[model samples]
Target: MTDQTEPVGEVDALMRQAALDAERLLSGLRMFVALGLGLFFLVAVKPADALQEPVLLRQWAFAGSTMMGYFLLGLLTWILSARGLFRMWGVWVVATADTLFVLSGLWLSLMNTGLEPGAIFVFPSAWLVPLVLAFAVIRGDPWVMAFTVAVLCLGLALLAIGGAESGQQGRRETLDLFLSLPPNVMRLAMIALAGIVLVTAARRVRRLLLRSIRDARSRANLTRYLPAQLADDLGEVGLAALQRGSRQEVGLLFVDIRGFTGMTQEMPPEKVSEFVSDYRRRVSAAAEKTRGIIDKFMGDAVLIVFEGDGAARRCLDCGLMLRADIADWSKARTMRGDAPVRVGIGMHWGEVFRGVVGDANRLEYSVFGDAVNIAARLESLTREMEMDVIASRDLIATAKAEAGSLGFIDLEPIEVRGRTGALALSGVAKDAPLRSAGTAAPVSGSSS
Candidate 1:
């Protein structure tokens, strides 16, 4: 059986890389936030005013402990990512650590500021709501964000009730505190609102990230069946273009490896696959240079379509370039002690229908009509005529003045299979002497 491990390994590696990158980002943000919070606490405490309220020392102590805890946690997360352990549930570790730190930081802030009239309390602690929510967003999981918000609300409610009781206030005063509702109710409402906003924002960002990840996966999958450029265009243009069949004049280029079947008959499956893959890669590279969209691959043959203005010219240019590319590729293969490869290509330009085909569950985008058929017939004629490339007279004529400059050998009209009349064809030798115009030059220095 063919090995499937390589592709799976690649995907796993990509996911791990994404996770590690996220961990590193969160770690840096954690350190910055911790340091900022520490400075804020230091400024609020005002060492000069400490003499006036000896209680301020306790506040400073709490702030110091909270900040130090945050720094240590951040350091731990960074080390985990550096050691590559962050890929093993690092998101959860960061989220849990950050959630706890924020919750504790809120409590410490609340206690230090005090609940008494004329003394700061809820506002200082409320600043952390957005920070914790920010952590939720960075985590990129709605459940984690929701969990953080829920725990924070519970913590705030407990702190409010607990602080009022701890003051040893009378039952009436305790009831009055709950009913007053300015700081407590308002603080809870703000937390809820902030949680809603942050969670909504996080969910939106998570959706976008998910879409990007899905798109990447889809592109990877599509490349297996379609040309990379065509797959990308399909994504950009959307399937709607295919759902409605349309006809447009397009340049069709059909490429088939000469003697590929006979050459691979005696080879092992692995070697055959490798050889075909290498040939396809070279053809794809050359075709892409001329803005050709790969229509499909049928066995050892590739069908490419060139649409829009100047399609015919691009198609012929691409064919000449492919001839040069194959020459260099064959030479490199011979140098490496491998069998030299040869290909036959045919170019035709005509109106073809483009649309989606197949059932709803397994729809396919394809092109049809005489344009595609003529291109295939010409490709087959390349072998019978003992020529490397062939172009229909119509394609040459449609290309304007392009065919004349390339020095193509005109041939008599030849009957093609499944067609009533013979097609006027011209042949271009693979090693045709390069003209001064250099139309057949390979687009890139490295053909392989």
Candidate 2:
């Protein structure tokens, strides 16, 4: 059996691309921030405000250089990411650079102000730590967020050596909470708490994104073998819910290409494949048009099930459409000196066990019962009766009452083996050498 679960590697690949896009967006935003801050320092802040002491102007020069470096690096990263040159590992590199640039600006600004190192907590630049962490969140990688927060907290601790008044010993009650070492210690704790929450939220978002991708792949797989509508219903209700099979009255149609084996015995493998593919396409189109569920197709034979109201009538119409289409296709092949393709259809309507079956290791939607068996039996007789379509009397009766009697020839009733009584059958046909000289009578078993 083929693997059904969506691969985790595929999910990871999608997330990697998403992370790249997020990083590029964060970089572009950072460039604007750097540009604005740099311009503010250059034009808005006067020289006296920028340099408390004329001699400290040299330190401010280094700070200004860091800002310029930040802007240039952000722009380059953004461009590289857009061109698909950036890698996942590069996210941590960018995060470190961003934290350092902001930290140096605050540290240098404090240096010029001559405030005790502890006063860095009151500096406006400290708020940028939260913004940096927020950008990390956009990357949707918890590891990146945790790394940025860890770096910022460490930098804050080093800057806060003893954040206390002279001889105060950094006592929590004595030193101003907002300005001193002890309170800012508590503030750092809060920041760590917030980081933890954001990281948790980001992890949850990643899981949800992966689940969405997995579900989409699974739905596509279902559509591959089942009808589009059935697949859609299963997706909405969920496959687990379908594990408990239900008894449903459905119109069952079984069809197989007549003489497929002998006709393709001498044909090349390519031709044989083409013949089967073409045959299925025609039948599927007809089935879809009538809203029939292509329960499954085993090689050249397909078992179709019609559901809901008026299923019997719709199934009959589908069979008729398929018969004529295959006949027309066969005639064209005959003209081309290729073997003609022909099919036989058997249809029945009744209650059947329909739902998913098997253990969790293997599960499939299936339909089986006496009704399904009767349908197959009828299709098998199509060859013996020299007919292209054979349908049960009960199915004909249902369709006739629901819509109107379909165009089918009344054939002699035959005794089906393993059944209690004879089954009244009918057919629509042309001719076949398989027809026996004996009249229609007791017959059992079928190739269908």
Candidate 3:
């Protein structure tokens, strides 16, 4: 049994690890594509112009220098992508390189004696590309986005002001003269294209912001079920898995504060709320610590699920630790002349159907199966059998022999409802001495 189980566990572990590796690979691919495409656009827009003659060789050398700077910027982007670094420093590096490349081209265009109308349009477009790319890569930082927006606005404003100044000097054609012509139409066309790009980028950013907000809310909700580490894993894996149901064996646990109703009856509404809140906090802490998913909270009860024995054992340990903590809490409350609370916990191992359920407006990621039913029944049985903790025969059989040393004692076989086969019930006393195995005893209750 151990041999067969061990291999299956190893295979599952390997598959999970492979999925993580695949995600990292995809992220790297996206980074490369983003950089590569940006570079391709830059090169396509501005081809190096050729020069002739000895006197013009100096001009050629100057043009070559600008092209060299552009290539260097691309090289820097590739290097950053290869390093697999994600930080503000990388954003700054890329932004600086891109700015320098744009400014160099702008300077060359300004110095050129015979600048074509096309060159003027291309120069600003080149600057726009890098600014937009930098903004996209570092959108998480508000400062970066602010800087990009400021720069684009400043650049456009300066162009408008400069055009106005040139028109006023009477050295250039009047603003109206250019506006009425076919070349003016081309200039308007370029401006229209740039406007489209800006609108598209703004829409993209808006969608991204909405997604970020939704993700933050989803994560806050998920933390109710998962620990910080597991929550991070789930987020990295994304919501697609939850949307599509998956088949897997998982350990389910159900816990209820025994005598909670009686305790609540003895207190005022406010005091009852306080007590329930404290109980939830304690149980939630324990569940998260053990990597158990608290599927649902029903009045005074909590339904938790563990992925496997490793997770289940952790949950068991958490339950034991929680019992000790609650005992300490009860003692403190008694010392202060306050009320105490008792808790009943049950665990079972079985295959579960896990997925998102409900309508589009109100969907929830949950687990459903006979395993969940059995775990609930076990919790219900805890009240009848006067046991603080109860587990199924499946859990007991799967548990390591050392687990029995941890105060797990096999109880009598009992038939559960909706099932033809009888099951071996087990119990572990809250304050029982560790490593003591007691005799199995029959339980007297109808299976839930």
The candidate that wins on lDDT is 2
Clash total of candidate 2: 0
| Model 2, global lDDT | 0.70
Residues 1-448 of candidate 1 have per-residue lDDT tens digits of 1122445676566666655666676676667666766655555455665556444465556657877887787788888777777664657666776666656755654454444432224344455667667767665556667877787777666665564223633334433433443334434543554565456556656876899899888667655555455553555455566567688888999999888878999899999999889888877886778877887778888998887667888888888877777777887888898888888988898889976666544555688998888888889888888888899988888887455558689877877676678888888866665332236332442435
Worst-scoring 10-residue span by lDDT in model 3: 439-448
lDDT of 2 by residue, 11-104 (tens): 6877898788887877776776666555555553446653663523554476468767877888999899978899988988989987887688
The candidate with the higher lDDT, 1 or 2, is: 2
Model 1: lowest-lDDT 10 consecutive positions: 116-125
> Which residue pairs of candidate 3 clash?
none
**Candidate 2 lDDT for residue 428:** 72
CA lDDT of each prediction against the hidden true structure? 0.69, 0.70, 0.57
Clashes of each: 0, 0, 0
Error of 1 at 344 (Å): 2.3
How high is each candidate's TM-score? 0.52, 0.51, 0.54
In model 3, the runs with Cα more than 4 Å from the true position are 1-54, 57-230, 336-340, 417-421, 434-448
